[model samples]
Target: MISIGHSPDADDLFMYYAIVFGWVGDDLEEKFENQALDIETLNIATIQGIYDVSAISFGAYPFVRENFALLQTGVSFGDGYGPKLIRKKTTQLKKNFRVALSGVHTTNAIIFRLAYPEARIVYKNFLEIESAVISGEVDAGVLIHESILNFDTSLEVEREIWDIWCEKAQEELPLPLGGMALRRSIPLNKAINIESTLTKAVEVAVKNKKILSKMLIERGVIRVDEKELDIYLDLYANKDSISLNDLQKKGINKLFELGFKAGIYDVLLECEDYFIPTGYQALRNS
Candidate 1:
């Protein structure tokens, strides 16, 4: 059995559940066992080489480049919106304000730190960030996943992380959030097969999004209700997520460059160079 680790967020569930439901890859000999954890936990697990395949924050990918190569499918991007930095209404943030972030290794945290170098940061689970801000546990907190959509009225948006991404990007590009990566130790042929299967799984999921969404709601598999889940899926789990198009690949490269320039990475790596070479499968068969 191949182990898979992903966030329990609606987007991750939307992309991965087709495999669980046996709607795709039924002909393959491999069996997939999935574990749902918070994105931060999955990021740490990916760096440790714990799962054969995992969903990881793009910011965390540079550290694990040697052991894991990115998969083309199952990526999340923010076009014009993303994680929100929120604080209690009528409160003004100081330069050294204490803030709660989802995790130290998350993409939002990494970018948030770069944007607010003087801010004091504490790590908390994504679920706790909103409450932390409300209770004065911190001056502000970054809300991710579904929290970005339906935050409490008492809290107000301080800034959007996507704005920071745009300023740093210096060009039009989607904000690269998270993606799937496969362990490089897997044999090339088997790796190719697995990537193909997973790619199809994502495509199938997008094609049958309505059907799958209903199934998830009926089974109580996702945290959000149908309306919230539908909106979240469109933002993060749509057709663009099925594979890395040229633009998305460029976006990932830009993220790596940004991380490298900020001293978060030792080297600047091209994102496409690290993907599993599926073309090799055809060559070997021929």
Candidate 2:
């Protein structure tokens, strides 16, 4: 059995549930089981090599490349928008202002650090960030996940992480936020097969979007209700999330370059070097 792990957020669930629901078909040589955790927890578990496959932050990928290889499918990227930095009304932020981050290793946090190197940072669960800011626990907090949509009215967006990405990325690349990773020790054939299966799962989910959304809501598999979940899924689990394209690959490489330059990584590495090999299937078919 292969253990797959992903965040409990609606986007992650939406991308993976077709396989969970048996809609991907039962023609697998390996059995699959899934577990859900918060993104931070999943990233930490990735350090331990806990799952055969797991959803990991792009920021954390640089550190774990030896243990996990990037999977092209099941990714989340942002075009014109992404996580928001917010604070209670009229609270001006200074360069040295303290901020609450989802986690030190999240993609948003990575950009936030590079953008505001002097800002004092404290890590908190994504859910508690708004209250922490409102209670004056910190000068600001970076809101991620579904919180970017319909946040507390009292708070205001200071700026978006996407804006930072645009300034840093000269290329017209979307910001790579999260994607699935496979354990490097797995056989190349099995790893490639799993990646293909996941790509199909995402395609099926997007093709049958309404039905899956209703089922997810009815089964309480996601946090948001119908309308909000619909918006969230469209933002993160759309056609682009089905597989990595050339731009998506460049986006990830950009992230690695930035992280390495900022001293977050010990070495720079290419994203393509770690992806599961796909040429084997073509070779056999030929």
Candidate 3:
């Protein structure tokens, strides 16, 4: 049996549904068991090597790279958008202003830190971030995931993490947000099979997006209504999600490199070196 861990959020639910709905290889389907948790919880479990395969933040990769290899499929990238920093319309942040971040391991937090090192950060659940900002408990907060979709009118966007990313990246590369990680201790052959299964699952989901999205809403796996769900999925689970492209690999590497330089990681890593060897199948066929 293989255990798969992922977030319960809409994009994750959308991407993994093909496997959950039995659209992949039958044998692989029977062996699969999935666990749904919030992203921060999954990131912690992934670092502990608690699941055979788990979803993780790109920001968390540097810490877990020693034990897990990232899966090339089921990724979320933002081309011109991402997490948003929000504050009351009249609020003006001074240096060292307190900002609420979803989690220290979240991609948004990493970008926020790089952009505003002078700010003081406090961690909170993503669900509670908006309320904290509105309650006057924080000067600003970074809104992530579905929180970015709908927020209180009293709060205005201070800045988008996408803009922060663009300034930091200094080129046209999508921001690498989150993706799957598989335990390296799994024998190499088994790791390759799991990787291929996940890649196929993402492909199936993208091809049957309408049916899957409908099922997701009916099942209450998605929090947003149909219209918002459509928009949210397009943002995070669109074509870029089915597989990682060269540009995304570069983005992921840049994320790790910057994090390492900033002391977020003990060592620098190249993302390509950590992927499962799907090339083995082509070699066998040749």
Using lDDT as the measure, which candidate wins? 1
Q: What clash pairs does model 1 have?
A: none
Tens-digit per-residue lDDT, 1-286, candidate 3? 8888999888888888887777885765338788998788888998889999998999998788889988998999888999899999999999899999988898889989998999999999788889999999999999888889999999999898999998888876889998999998988777888888888888888888899999988988788999998899899998889889999999999898888888888888999888888787778779
The TM-score of predicted model 3 comes to 0.96
Q: Rate the local accuracy (lDDT) of all candidates.
A: 0.91, 0.90, 0.88
Candidate 2, residues 37-118, lDDT tens digits: the string is 9898888889889999999998898878998988999999998889999988879999999899988779999989989999
Clashes of each: 0, 0, 0
lDDT of 1 by residue, 41-153 (tens): 99999988999999999889988899999899998999998999999997899999999999888889988988999999999999999999999999999999999989889
Model 2, position 98: C-alpha lDDT score: 89
Q: Sorted on TM-score, highest at the top, how do the candidates line up?
A: 1, 2, 3
Q: Candidate 2 lDDT (Cα, whole model)?
A: 0.90
Assess the local accuracy of residue 79 in candidate 1 as a C-alpha lDDT between 0 and 100: 91
The reply for model 1, stretches above 4 Å from the true place, is none
TM-score of 2: 0.97
Evaluate residue 174 in candidate 3 and report its C-alpha lDDT on the 0 to 100 scale. Answer: 84
Q: Using lDDT as the measure, name the better of candidate 1 and candidate 2.
A: 1
